[model samples]
Target: MPEITYLEGIRLGLQRLMRERPEVVLYGEDVGAFGGAFKVTLGLQEEFGKDRVFDTPISESAILGSAVGMATQGLRPVVELQFVDFGMTAVHHLLNNAATTHYRTGIPVPMTVRAPCGGGFGGGPFHSEELESLFCLMPGLKVVYPAFPSDARGLIYSSVMDPNPVVFLENKYLYRHVKEIVPQSFEPVPLGAARVCRAGRDAVVLTYGAMVHEALRAAEQLASDGGYEVMVVDLRTLKPYDADTVLTAVAATNRVLIAHEGWRTNGFGAELSALVADRAFHLLDAPVRRVAAPDVPVPFAPELENAYRPNADKIATALLELMEY
Candidate 1:
């Protein structure tokens, strides 16, 4: 199989789906003629035409409201918010209308909101923020964040096919940088599945999205320098996270480290930490460690941002402490 960029893998999946499923439509700002801000939808407008794939106004609320309305009418809309940060602007429509429509009317509001997230590559405050925990907290929303190119391609298709509202978080940093041999025929990597990227026995690191690579780096460093085997868990989905996988990894390793690019306080790591504490506390040999960005606004300065973000060195440092404890 030929290798494809992570961004191209997403385009391939959407292109195949749009061609195969007439009900699938693309809606977002600059998605049609402009091919999206990141150019992930480039040339799609020409193939799918303006009707099936088109742009929308700058209002996130309007984009979400329109998707919900279309989903009810039996259209599976793939909505895009340019940046995850702007998703906050449309919280009302997403959390209240689309998320709760099924429970109120017993209907499947099948739609997926795609947004580029994470803070590496100096995207700054507005373009950088990771809001996984915010949507993960909502009862009706299913959040899926994939790290690898294969996962990126597969999860996008599954999210479109899902019955409820799904927030498909794409890391901007992984868009062009990451590449893998995605199968020629797209396959759906089911939601709520946990992939163990690298297996180990001394410690388990639970992570997703852009942070998965960082966690892997930490695992390598610990294994090479510290002589400690580390288990790295890539949570492809967030809201319906794989607790069974997490417990198993924690049980075998006896040490846990949860990390993410999102802020530490009230971040998704906090939720994962609490889950392990509640159910797998007895299996832990040390207090679960969390490595995350400080609870502050994302900075524009590259140097400051580097310090603000948690990377391999930082994660390894925390893991070493956990190993000692």
Candidate 2:
């Protein structure tokens, strides 16, 4: 095992997959020569060649449309949207075409759309955003949001191999900052599974992506300073989120706090809260609380950006209040 940044792990996984499968083709803006805006695809163009690894125009809709056509024609295309915010420009292809092709025609579109998501880099409204909830609403889509370097590598590999149109949401905020030692061998984590990052008996924190790290931090602070045990649940896959694992933790902890980088209203956190209330209401000692971004566009100012994103301190404060209630 070697310590690697989250982006490096993804690069390794893609490289391994491309070597293993000839059908795997990657295309996106600056993916070839520039190695992507975040350098996740650095050195890939030289290895895979221009035919297999190429650049695309600046249209997100065109990129997604091309992926759909390629997938249907027997090519496993991995399309990258430079930023998640640009996904709005191609909502039709994502919502109607990529997501419904399987249901409408009984064909497996083995394609992946990887996009840099979340706020923290002061990327402002146009560059940073989380649109997982938008695609999660579609029945045939698989949504993956991984927090750690190892999980990011594993989940992205799985998404590339999956039969459905999977949206791999990479928290750009974690790309260079989050580090972990990953095994050389690439393993694919199955979709719809949740991992309990930390165990506790007082309260449970249901979260995913970069928020998982924040939740773990809050759990640590709660134990060290507040004497509260916070169970941290990381839902690696958002679309078919692990309900059983979530309920089990909620039952044991009795209190739940759902957290994510997405907005509070109609966000993934709200959906998780609904899932807990629907199936595990009897086990809850207190009402489920959601910690998420404020309902507004991401701000360009550094201070406002910090206020918009949920952090360890905010998560810890919410957990403490929920425990008291």
Candidate 3:
């Protein structure tokens, strides 16, 4: 086993998908010889050729519209957006066309949109936005966000294989910041599953993506600082999230705290909070809390970005409030 970063894991998965499935194709802006804005697709064009792996123009709407067409014609097209924030320009293709294709025309749109999201390095507003909730609200799109390298590798395979539109969000900050030793090969992680990364009885933090790692750090800090054991649940898939696992964690812990890097108002955390309130209202020992970015654009200055982003310290403080409540 070799230790690989989160970005490498995604690339490995893309490589495997292209090699195993000849019908699979990858294209995006600057994704060819340029290797993508973050170099996640470096050397893929040479190995897979310009036909299967190539670059496209700056028009996201045109890129996604073509992908929807390709998917209907029996091609698995993986399109990447330089940043998830830019996706708003062409969301109608995803919402009206790709999402409603199957129900309207009985044709499956098996296209995967790879989007780099989140902010920790001062990408400002245009480059650093967490819009998972916006995608999740669409009826026909499946949203997947991986917190670990192993999960990133496995989920990409599953996302590409699924016979529907999938939004695969990659946390930009975690590309090189997180690493793990994974097997040379592994099984595909099923969509809509949640993993309990840490066990505890006091409280549980419901989160995903980069926040999962922060929740783990907060759990450790709480364990040492207050002798409080905090549980952390990573909701790997957002749309068809693992409700059973979440309810179970809430039942066992009796306290819940939702953490995310997105805006607190109407963010994905609100959905999770609603789920707990609806089904497991009686199981709570305290009011469900949230630690998320305030409702504002992501700041450009490093200091401002640091305050704008939800971190381990914020999570820890929220956990303490939940525990004390």
How well does each candidate superpose onto the true structure, as a TM-score? Answer: 0.98, 0.98, 0.99
Query: lDDT of candidate 2?
Result: 0.90
lDDT by residue (tens digit), candidate 2, 157-242: 88898888999989998998899977788678888899999999999899998899999999999999989878999999998889
In angstroms, the error of model 1 at 295 is 0.4
- Stretches of candidate 2 off by over 4 Å are none
The residue ranges of model 3 lying beyond 4 angstroms of the native Cα positions read none
lDDT of 1 by residue, 1-325 (tens): 8799889878887988898899999989999978999998999889989999998889898999999999999999998999999989888888899889989999999999999999878888898998899998888999999999888888999999998999999999889888897558866899999999999999999999888999998899988898999999999999899999999999899999998999999999998999999999999899999999999999989999999999989999999999999
Of 1 and 2, the candidate ahead on lDDT is 1
| Residue 306 lDDT in candidate 3 | 90
Q: Which candidate model has the greater TM-score, 1 or 3? A: 3
Using lDDT as the measure, the top candidate is: 3
Note the residue pairs that clash in candidate 2. Answer: none
Minimal lDDT window, size 10, model 1: 179-188
Model 1 bad stretches (over 4 Å): none
- lDDT of each candidate versus the true structure: 0.91, 0.90, 0.95
Looking at model 3, report the run of 10 residues with the lowest lDDT sum: 316-325
